[model samples]
Target: MTNILIADDDIHVLNLIDIHLTEQGYKVFKAYNGIEALEILNKELCSLAVVDVMMPFMDGYTLTKEIRNLFNIPVILLTAKNQIEDKERGFHAGTDDYLVKPFEPKELSFRIKALLRRYDNNPDEYIVRIGNTIINKKSYEVKVGKRTILLPLKEFELLYFLMSKPMQVFSRDHLIDQIWGLDYEGDERTVDVHIKRLRERFSKLTDHFQIKTVRGVGYSLEVNRE
Candidate 1:
């Protein structure tokens, strides 16, 4: 059975999400704040996490960062702040998805399912090589020559998807649909952000591969053959 940790300061919101997620056949763990959430995470293994932005001790942004640094689980942030900046912040903190407050329970459920599906790393589809860079899907590890580099979840997924089809132009919408799922309601700029992060992370590695923008279209991974 898949377990999920839901952390929120509001008792009502925590219970609401707990009931809905439990009814969906998930083993749910509830926490009243980020500290408790982290404590629970330390003791139990969960497949995913639903975290609230505002909390005592540690905020969702901080908790998500810690989770990303220490665990290989998908995180979805729930918050009342619906601004694009706030959403971007959540993504930058390594959250796989974001849901605003008062959001439909069904939408949250769909988002959770989508994230879990996308992040289900299979050992069979493990290694991908593009020039000197190697992507280990199963381990979520990236290697450039002898050095290893770590990327946030979203950035790593975006890189893997693009490298899977080198030189193929993928429109932002297509990338978002394939990577973030068709149910994602966020702006297309989210794709841009992830792409930018990928570029920055790999810039120092090698010049053999580059992510090129398509101006009016989208972007593509272009590999320079020797």
Candidate 2:
């Protein structure tokens, strides 16, 4: 079973997330503050993390920075602040995703699963042959034939997820839910941002191997079927 650490100052929030995640087959760990979160991080291998932005001792951004330096574990920041700058800072700080307050428990569960799916599938060689591109999961490196490309973590996650389910059309909401999380509180444009990044990266692989932007729909990874 995957292990998840959920850190929030609100006891009610912690309990709610714990129950929801536990029912979904994850080993849930709770921390009321950043200090406790660090303690949990020191002791175990967590597949994913859910952190609140505000708390005593250390904030979510600080803890995320520390965790990023130490591990490639995927993180979702929970914040009451829904500002664009906060989202940008969370991403810049190396959080894999973010969720604002007033989110649904089911949404939280989906995001956790999506992040876990991305993290747990990573292997040491750090290279994935998706279509004509060879993705280096570790260095965030991508190689299409002889060209080398670097990708942001979110872009990498999006590309990896789409490639994992080639030809499947993921609706914007479903894609967001699959990649971001159910409780992921953000505009759908977040998915668009990463998708654009993925397209730019794959453009190096030849436009033939690309993510199709389904009009009035969502996106799909469609390798040349001809």
Q: Which pairs in model 1 have colliding backbones?
A: none
Writing each residue's lDDT as its tens digit, candidate 2 over 114-220 gives 87777667583255454356666667776777888766667777776675455668888998887778999998989988888777656755654678889999988
Best by TM-score: 1
lDDT of 1 by residue, 1-226 (tens): 8999999999999888888988999999999888898778756668899999999999999999877654567899999998999999999999989999988888999999998887775443456666577888878888898999888888888888877666678899999999899899999999988888888878877886899999999998876643
Report model 2's TM-score to 2 decimal places.
0.55
lDDT of each: 0.85, 0.79
Task: For candidate 1, give the lDDT of residue 204.
Answer: 71
- TM-scores, all models, native as reference: 0.57, 0.55
